[model samples]
Target chain A: SVAEQLTPVLRESKFKESGRITPEEFVAAGDHLIFISPTWQWMTGDEAKIKSYLPRDKQFLVTKNVPCLRRCKQMEFTGVEKIVEDVEGEDGWVTHETDDMNLNECAEEMTLDSSKMDDIEPKNEDEDDDDQEALDMEEFDVDNVDPSVAIIKPTPIATTKDSETDSVIHTRTYDLHIVYNKYYQTPHLFLIGYDENRQVLNIDQMYEDVSQDNAKKTVTYEAHPHLGPSMLAVHPCKHSDLMKKFLQIAEEGGNELSVYSYLIIFLKFVQSVIPTVNYDFSQTIKTT
Target chain B: MSEKKVFQYVQFKSLVHHDFWHKLSDIKLDIEKLNESDKTIFGTFTNLNAKNCLLELDCTSFNSNFKTAKNNFYCKGTLKNLNTIESFKNFNRNELLKKEGENLLRIIENGSACKNPSELISFIVLTYADLKKYNFHYSFAFTASIEPLIYEVSPSQNITDEFSENDIENFSSSYHLLDQQQAAFFIATKHLDIILLQNALDVNQRDMNLKDHNLDSTYFCFSDPSEFPYAAWILRNFILLLVKLCPILHGKSIKILSVRRDEKSSLLLSKLFFIQLPNKIDLDPINMKWTGWERNDQGKLLPKLANMSNSMDPIKIAEHFS
Candidate 1:
């Protein structure tokens, strides 16, 4: 990363090669979201802790107190999730899960711990691949996250189950903060969780809300860069590669993705990690 | 043993975001330089929950005039930020604390603290922004009289008990902007009372809107930076102003709301505390025992140092991963 450090892709023109965004791109992407969505706001996390590089107000983006009502266990993914389990290991955009000889994961109707769901979930195969692999990415993230494993792409709203119909709807809230990842050169997302009574939740409790796919590998608990205290962070390691997928498509479609739409596409994919933290991701990516 | 009723007023703490130091460095290198002038800056202390009170300072705290977020329960307090490493190193910590305490006492005695309750809390931050090394050294102090008074803490109440989310927002954001008579202090209560009935939750709205017509207690709200059971130390002076001005509230309980929200709930996870007001009065400013100096984690009397190498170094800031 020395050369990557010395000559960081400081321009948006070279985004495809760098797979990183400059500070200016981060602000551009952030401002676009701010104007369109009230849910996403720019916060200067305590004045002292602000990264001098980013502008004061545009240091990070936060959509606060997003409601996450049900745990990942309650989510019922569609049947294709079983197919993903078969082809889970390698980077195989073309390798369709063949007819199974023997069953391993989803076929057994056993009551599995939700974290065990990772064994059945496919990995983030979005490494920086060549042209043909980039072509395979088109049908995946139109609304974002591979529709098959797109974290609980369930019925838009979870209908209350009957046995607990009158019981107090125990809901957890998460404060989602997105900060620039200078090394990965993409925007990183963090979650601060609160329990039913509005008290800060421990990491274990927060894990219950994160999708088992990401919970096992991608998400980590660490100190927030600006706001002190560790938060549940969705690692930005693969965000740029994932972002480049959108870039390749937009280039092929002859519509350049504006740096502003970075976060719009960002939240779309981040949904695949913590699918249920219902912050207002209500807008489509406006490419202008 | 016949027990005497003992009271403990909420203590305020400082939530000094690192941006304060960064701003101080910028000001020193660009504006102040070697002059080391006593710059007039300001900080805010909120009154949301008794245990969450804090006098907060950040990059904006250095500005002579600044406006906080509209609905955030932060009220303005004028403070003096003394600059330069030499001054910060040489000043008498005890004398500075006393001077700050006496300044607050003078405002209370002169009746200005009554006119603006926000003035009840004040401070002086002695700072040394070491630009070359990227280390910031500073000592912070908030003025509050060191006196034990009779008080009691009640359980935390949900904010919806007093008003709906909209009502709290309407009152807190607009309270400081008031201009008419009996405005600042009295405005908080009256403004909220009207909104409680106005923003009544629609029944078809949901089960969360099940709050009844509970007119239990009024709030003295401020954006609190601390968590529960430990309020910002700045509340001491505000409570003192209350005890000094309104004798009718003397020995009576006054409920204060922590206008701040915790990480858990975005819906103004504000906490309300019913505290028994002090029964006695002491107006002698000279004899007052003042206490408030930001402490080291080991509870020692020393200025804290923060190394900003990862934060301010050119290589670090330019290429460091999050």
Candidate 2:
């Protein structure tokens, strides 16, 4: 039933984007149901709007108008109080007697004013007074409570720093992009690193991460039309062999690494080369 | 330095599903039945166990024109020292096979079996023949483990005065010869792509005549008249060879013409090299018929042609050049 009421609002593009339903929107639907109910004459305009939102199949019996009020009073009070208590407990706002006191006070107010409310205008004013009283009570409670007592305690901060930095070996994270060079008919790895500031890392920064032998043997300074002039690419002649070795290492490590997502596995293998740098795809960068 | 003798053993791991030991016993029973009914097929079985079994075929005793006549094959092995099925659950079948193979190689190299042995342990060669044909042809499958005698060549014993870097590159590139034994292991384990590359290199050396080629391009067509089960091997090998030897052909645009293509073979080709099937063209080369088609920028092969003819027509191959 709640889903049925919310579906139209949820389908709205703006609501979908924001991923929320405002209280006013929820109340508006409730108002529509109240306006269509059989007890419209007994309700004020505001009450009618609220009651009209209730389902048409259920008959709304005004509590005082019921013939057997004496029998239903105890049952009604217990059920309503239980629901309110459960909701208050979940919200962590269970003041010792606030909800029970409010319910009794509202009931006393309703009984004292029942004989005075014959016309719609007076009934509307009485409903406004009740709402104002509830709002005032909430404000009074907030003002009276101590700030320290009212505030929820924050979670304890994690004591552990990046364990990698303290270890003998230092590690870094890099972004690996494996582009299929149609001309070479081979996969080419485009590696970039992140600085401490998380910007596109310089070639000089990456040089420190790689071994001196591998830096000389495999790394080549090449102008990538998209990545720019400083981009370092793995030498094409050794690309296939290097890939085979990377795959072999991955296989030995117990990763199935399918032919389709070999690029992800390639990035994983390159993690060993950089050791410290986390290797991830470019798409992940855009999302984060 | 002295020449050192190395001893190695090829270990087979048990198949987790479908009892391998039971299957071998069944085969042993079939061999006995064949020996009773057929005079041509003679087999001897020994050391049969849950972990080990030996099957020896005496083809020399039978009179035949088959190549098996010259080769007396011995396949005596056991599937022991294996990881349990629980451990296997974490690994892909290919990865497990490869790990097992490497482990077996390690055991052969340094295990107690190699220390102070009575006699030298040599590598065994296995030959499988298709007996359905009148004259059966045998294919050699090599195991990964090998026992080779190492020779000592001192640095001071330099035969050549000097050699260029290009000379060294060429020497090293051709030196290892792509270890057919390792290639065979890959094939037996269904490592299709590696086998494709190795077989392609082998086919390229045997089929292509590089002597007359000052030309920009050349085509090598392989055809076998017999119902070869591994006919697709040629096409796979050729495709890989093109990528390895002449990557520039990717830009030049190579086309594969096939008369009939099946989904499984097409999917395999697509997975190995992300090439999709192309639109059909009306150009029909003389003596060659095109059925199913897939064209790519790298290169293509007419898989159906391998099955259609005993040898590819040179004139038809020239049509691509034109």
Candidate 3:
């Protein structure tokens, strides 16, 4: 990309030095993202718009109908206001305040953020381990053990007994996509929302879910150059800058980052824009 | 601002066999000798889990007895071969298509389509054959005179959701009911009793029984030609016929079945919709301007030409021409 050649940070782009990614790195990172989160699938947008730089099937990534059950304003009732810095008149994302929480929300955010890595793995992998444990228990004649010797199968307490009736189920869903912008040389995030009946949500209606402060400044409706209709996009102009800050923080904490983990980190920071959308984007940036 | 929910209709395209041109040449040379007049032609199409609606025509389509010639699923239509290219170009297409719609209205009004159910779906074809050059200019219109029809598409999908795979299998039908294909727009009674619309005694009795059926059950359905998001073009005429059959059904919702098949697996991909026709049909001809003329490859509103000079015998044709 011209931007990759001209930009000062990308001209000397080492993982810790800059956030900008090359086209080849983006495709490799995309494969890693799809492996960790199966919900994120590859799509070759429009046939005419397929990029020669990328493979046919790996044009972009999409996770459809990620449920956004509450308005951002509703979440602000409990969430701490973390102000996102203004970027040069650009497009980008907003974040969701924690929706489902325990009595305390600050602690809930920390637990939820840290726990997501383990929560989003394919269940089939764990199921086999569980089956092997059961077989070992049978060989040990565990079923014949006395009540005192046996491990008690304690039942989990309900989060709410009569909660569903009171809370209104919002039928709004968002289709999230990760598109590679050659100019910005970054994976630009785009979102289009729909109501209950699958009718597309207009700009004004879609704004209801976006964090009120960022929606006007960072978010803008841009038609996907190669895919479906126009969608609310977070300006990619500031993405590299934000990534540099994240890498600086990681470096200060004595940790190094891999290019394969770029999209996961990208999604984690992007949560600051579309915070309400419940897509399975990684909660915490991981390093290996 | 909220975007309006625009419903798209599934459409049919023409499939002309090579022999159909040969038959037209024979008729032009001997039978039609510059006498430009309309003639009846049968178009056969099968909706057996099909994604595209193919309105097919062959040499046998020119036969007068082709309607009852054992090929069951067919659409009744008219063919007009203009003598000159200028005449074909200058011809008032709106007038011809409106006339066809007027004929359909007359049949619906006279209670003929109700009894026979075969005249419900119809089409018209126009062509200008340059016999000496062996090139052809042709166009088609499957007209549905939607004059006073105000259709309301329901946001609620209760009827469509309830109408299941078993119901679709039972509504197993062909193009022409007169050919003995089991067709009903299948009904889902309050008690879940599925009945074929054809087997029902009369419109009055069905209306009487379904007077309050708007509460629990869906009434009136037809095999749709569209694999589009909404109902197809043929359903427009079918709905008009239903409104004519039972006038009480005005302002009432009618269920539709758009059955399609998977190209690879051949599995049925049928969808149901409940559309409400609010206004009563005006006995007068539809005065509304229509625009369903098939477009070119680039989606422009222009006529296409097929030059067959390459496929002809050069020496014999050159001698004959000279």
Candidate 4:
């Protein structure tokens, strides 16, 4: 299974380590394969080498900051560009944003309700050694428990100049937005789930509102503040299935699957959920 | 946003060589000391733009003239005693000659190897001519120091000719010259832009590299690799700015990893690779080589991390998009 997950990355690279395979063995391993870098240093490479191997439409979910050269004609690859160097604290911020629901509800629904949906659980968490050990040793049941409720803190809400409701939490049909201070030290995602009366609902209450005895699914994402919220939304018509799977995973505390490495994870997740989400280079301008 | 500074210098040698004594005018300078601000650190009154450039002048008179020449042309009273800038610095005579000598050798090596090296010969010749003017005062000068052949710009006397076998023979017979080397760190009043690199992906060709990744954000610095200690300081400030701006990106969600590559071998050392992945607590783990985490002598985690030392729970953090 690890090998399967690693196939994609390996397919995109020509291994140079002694124990690693030669180019021929890699070719035989073949296309559209999944791969995982054992550590972040693997991403560091000369520009020509990285350009030659990385796929045009594939995913590159780097969890670390390492220099890489992309877009080399000598490498026989195209559409490779160093979009950005993600220096964790120096460059930018990627904050997780939650809805009214909590982690327990998410985990329970993901595992217990998997029979109802045909989506694959996010594999990122599976690579975590500690999580694998935890899953192996502990069996948590989410049916009887309720997530915790906290004291409601009121804060000013930012809105457009034309809008009238200034400090109130607006109840929309689809999503909930929580106000986080700019100086907040943690990137934790927070959301205030509310009822029709604009009252905040705690975790157990949110679970009951969804009211599916069987597993329900949903897709959750951390808001990449720089990209705006539109990138967080599921494709049109593709939300139903994704929502079902996402909800199930979240109900079971499946936070691991939803955490992302780079923007590519979201793109891959998007393409996987909605096949119509184009990964075509024809639509992408060659900036390099 | 602090006030920026610009560096400007006047070449006294230029004015003296150009026969522009009458044209010389007073210049004022508002030069300040490094730390002390209250007392007038250094000021000048008289200008020497018209005076026959005195090769040697007392520190006080030179300081006064410096102030008159240019309000900003004053040094820290260090260079007033000597006509040449090299006289101000307390460098060992041998060391100065050695460094400058090495510089001359580097020039020769570069000139011999590079194409269109006419400028190299011109620079050397100009420097030699300047030193020749002071030859009478320094009797210890060696015969090898200023060989006639070294000064010979043959035929039309232009020093721009490509090196021939005969030129090599002439150079072997030519003597060497001594000059002081330049300083290591030269801080001028030039404005510089610093770009912060985040992911280290191929960015040389991208207009939207850092700016695209994070909406157009203003960065305080982009350090040059040549500036070592200063570069490190700049990097530290850049990190401090990010922490002040967005502290959430400090911990577990993102990790900062660095590896030093051997310039000659290209070998990557594993232990040299430092990674600061977010632990349970949101703060980044400090794993600097000499100093590990900021902890007490008890070998315990620092006070800030004591509560969350074992908090790195294996909570599923990423989603698998099928």
Ranking by TM-score: 1, 3, 2, 4
Per-candidate TM-scores read: 0.51, 0.18, 0.46, 0.17
Cα DockQ of the candidate 1 complex: 0.04
True contacts kept of 2: 0.00
Q: A8 in model 4: Cα distance from truth in Å?
A: 9.8
Q: Write the per-residue lDDT of candidate 4 for residues A16-81, one digit (tens) a residue.
A: 111122222322222211122211111111121122333321112112111111101111111222
Interface DockQ per candidate: 0.04, 0.00, 0.01, 0.00
**Model 1 spans > 4 angstroms off:** A1-265, A268-288, B1-15, B44-56, B71-89, B106-117, B153-223, B257-272, B313-322
Q: On a 0 to 1 DockQ scale, where is model 3?
A: 0.01
Question: What residue runs in model 2 are displaced by over 4 Å at the alpha carbon?
Answer: A1-173, A199-201, A242-258, A280-288, B1-322
lDDT of 4: 0.20
Taking chain A of model 3 alone, its TM-score versus the true chain A equals 0.68
Candidate 1 lDDT, A59-138, residue by residue in tens: 78866557775555544342222212212354312111212221123223222333443332221221222411322212
> Model 4 Cα displacement at A24 (Å)?
13
| Model with the higher DockQ, candidate 1 or 2 | 1
Q: What is the lDDT of residue B21 in candidate 1?
A: 65
User: Candidate 3 clash total?
Assistant: 18
Per-residue lDDT over B199-226 for candidate 3, one digit per residue giving the tens place of the 0 to 100 score: 4435545465445556336544555444
Question: Which runs in model 4 stand beyond 4 Å of their true positions?
Answer: A1-288, B1-322
Could you give the TM-score of chain B for each candidate, in order?
A: 0.68, 0.22, 0.78, 0.18
